[model samples]
Target: MNKDSTQTALLWIVAAGFFMQALDTTIVNTALPSIAHSLGVRPLVMQWAIVAYTLTMATLTPASGWLADRFGTRRVYFTAILIFVLGSVCCASSHTLGQLVIARVLQGIGGSMLLPIGRLAVLRSVSGEQYVSALAMISVAGQVGPIVGPTLGGWFVEAISWHWIFLINVPIGVVGLFAVHRYLPRATSTAAPRFDLTGCALLSLCMIAFSLAVDAPSQSHRAAWSTGLFALGLVSALAYVPYARSRRNPLFKLSLFREPNFSVGLIGNLVCRIGSSAVPFLVPLLLQLQLGYAPLQSGLMMLPAALSGTLAKRWIAPLIRRFGYDTFLLVNTLIVGGSIVAFALITPSTPAIVAIVVLIVFGAANSMQFAAMNSVTLKGLSHEDAGGGNSLFSMVQMLAMGLGVSISGTLVKLFSDQWGSAIFGFRMSFVCVGGITLVAALIFRQIKETPPAIASPAKPAVAGGR
Candidate 1:
């Protein structure tokens, strides 16, 4: 294959990895009830399956880049697919919630690596000119998974069984394993840096503690455990600063923060995502629980946002080129946050057209924000810092989603109990989450007028037997 064709083929393979990971993320959400019924557990109690997957992913994300460097990207990426497929089979064969949760943890181990490593590969594979569009294209494919996942999961449960939700992964994963080996170039370091075991443990503890703390409110009514865990997470995070400073080689170099755009962009990404991420979890519940829509219908309602997001990728490059990242992100952040607030107005009496428009606007703005933030964050890093920086960014992204869900769920519960109305609880949750998103604009404002220049090219790769 020619260079252009080789690049295209590589991207599609990476997208397949993304699709498998993204599909699993949302697909299981819709099937939870059916799976619970089969396993003889309350649907509410099955949340562990989701939590275990996300928490495990967040905990293990810091290690992906190191593993890819120590091994080779092709070998690691292919192995990730194999592990994810095996976990899916385990999930399908499970007869208890405990077993499913364990299987989900196994899946998370692989799922965590898919996007970050695939992205690192793309960053290494493409030129500066192709970078934005390449990432956007990959984002488009990843977006497609969420678009189809819920609707497909619901249909499978109704027409077949919840087991099909996982079984569907087997065929796609089988294809991916071969495609990865065929198309992806080898990426490995001759002298990989020594693993930062101490820093890794500390960071992992911090993520786990924080995630479990926030998630506790949703799973149980106890405040003491939640508060304690939150404190422990905070301390663990603070502890990392000192360890990183004293250590010769830290998991993530503190000097990464010296890059202005990266620091501001990273903070903006985390805070903004925490607020916006809740929409996926909240919107479907609002549709089914309050609006009395069926699971399939609720899933279908997500289409407008997903489709708009897919189309919105094309708009990002021009906007950033014209307005610049600092200005574009600052203005667009509000739009994203405001759109979240707009959901509060969505009721059964609300016009379908109005609700769809809200979703589309939110989706478009959110997609742009993500593409821009990711570029700005990674663009500033030195080539040597790339692996650690990418891992940290990925960790924050996963943890933010978990935080978003936990915060939204807690708020809804609080307001629902206070008002004795479920709809009112949802409205309040939207407002609160949106407000938190809006605050992220202040963080984005700290970005400088110009983006930092890329300092070096990523390591070389071979495609089409180059």
Candidate 2:
């Protein structure tokens, strides 16, 4: 085959990896209740399934680049597919929540490697001019995943069984394994940086401690356990700063935070995502558990948001050019947060039209917010620091997502018993999460000077995994 044809084939192979990873993120959300029932666990307590996958991904993603550099990209990418497929098989075979969470961690490990390695393969194979279009093509798979994942997962559960939701990855992975081996070029970085084992350990432990604390079972000793975990997590995370400062080649440079916009944007992304990330997880539950919607029906209801988010991409550059990042983010953050809060108004008697409108509005604002915030965050980085900055930004994005679900789940669990109903619990959960997001808008105000916005549409930073 010609070079162009070879590159085209390589792009598709990588896209398959992107699609599988993105699909798994949303697919399981709609199936949470069904999976919980099958495992004989309470639906409310099943947030661990989502948390485990996302947290593992966040914890492991920083290592992907080094692995691809040390081992060849083709070999690493192939192994990722293999491991992901094995994880899926394990998930389908799981009989208990513990088994499922363990399977998800395995899946997350594979997922953490897939996208970065695939992207590396593309960069190594393609020329500079071709890079943008190549990445755009791969990103389409990411976009389509969220669009169809929930609905597809719902259909699998309702028509067949929840296990099919996981088993579906088997065929895709099989094909990916074959295509990657054939089409991807082999390459390795000549000067791969030393692995930051200590930094990785500290950050991973901190994330686990915090997530476990937040998701701790609501019991007589809950407060004590949560407090200890929170303190440990905070201290461990803070310790990374000093460690990074002392090391000549740390995992991430502490100096990256000196840029005002970068600092503020990072904080804003984490805080805002913590509030908004709960929407995808919450919407399906509200529709199925509170109202009378079936799993498939609830999944389909997500279409409005997904569709509008796609369409909203075109509007981002124009808006950023006009209002600039500072003004745009300030106003848009409220819209996103308020839209989340609006879900509290949803009830059985609420008109479907009203809910659809709300979803569309929220989708558009959130999409714009993602594009703006990501651009601002990375836009300030010097070329030397861009890769590490981008990697850390993506890590925080996933971490916040897992944290969001834990926060939302714990709130719902707490209020359900307090208010004596799941509906009220959900309502209060939305309000609290929304309030957290609204407060996050204040952090954005710290961006005193606006940075130049990029002309390209930014990919939606994955929240909680998706």
lDDT of candidates 1 onward, in order: 0.80, 0.87
C-alpha root-mean-square deviation, each candidate: 4.4, 1.9
- Candidate 1 segments whose C-alpha is farther than 4 A from its true place: 1-12, 36-47, 117-140, 179-191, 218-221, 451-466
Cα lDDT tens digits for candidate 1, 94-202? 9999999899999999988887678777877888888767766776567678879988987888788889999999999999998888778766664678889899888
Instruction: Write model 2 residue lDDT over 1-466, tens digit each, in one string.
Output: 7889899999999999999999998899899989988999988788889999999999999999899888888889999999999999999999999999999999999999988888878878988878878888888898899889989989998999999999999999999999987887766556677899999999999989999898865686988899899999999999999999999999999989987888898999999999878999998989988898899998899888988988898888888888887788889999999999999999999999999999999888887788778888777777787778878888888899899999999999999988799999999999999999998789887876764466332332332123
TM-score of model number 2: 0.97
Name the candidate that leads on TM-score: 2
Q: After superposition, how far is residue 210 of candidate 1 from its true place, in Å?
A: 0.8
Q: Relative to the unseen true structure, what is the Cα RMSD of model 2?
A: 1.9
Provide the global lDDT of candidate 2 against the true structure: 0.87
Instruction: Provide the lDDT at 314 for model 1.
Output: 75
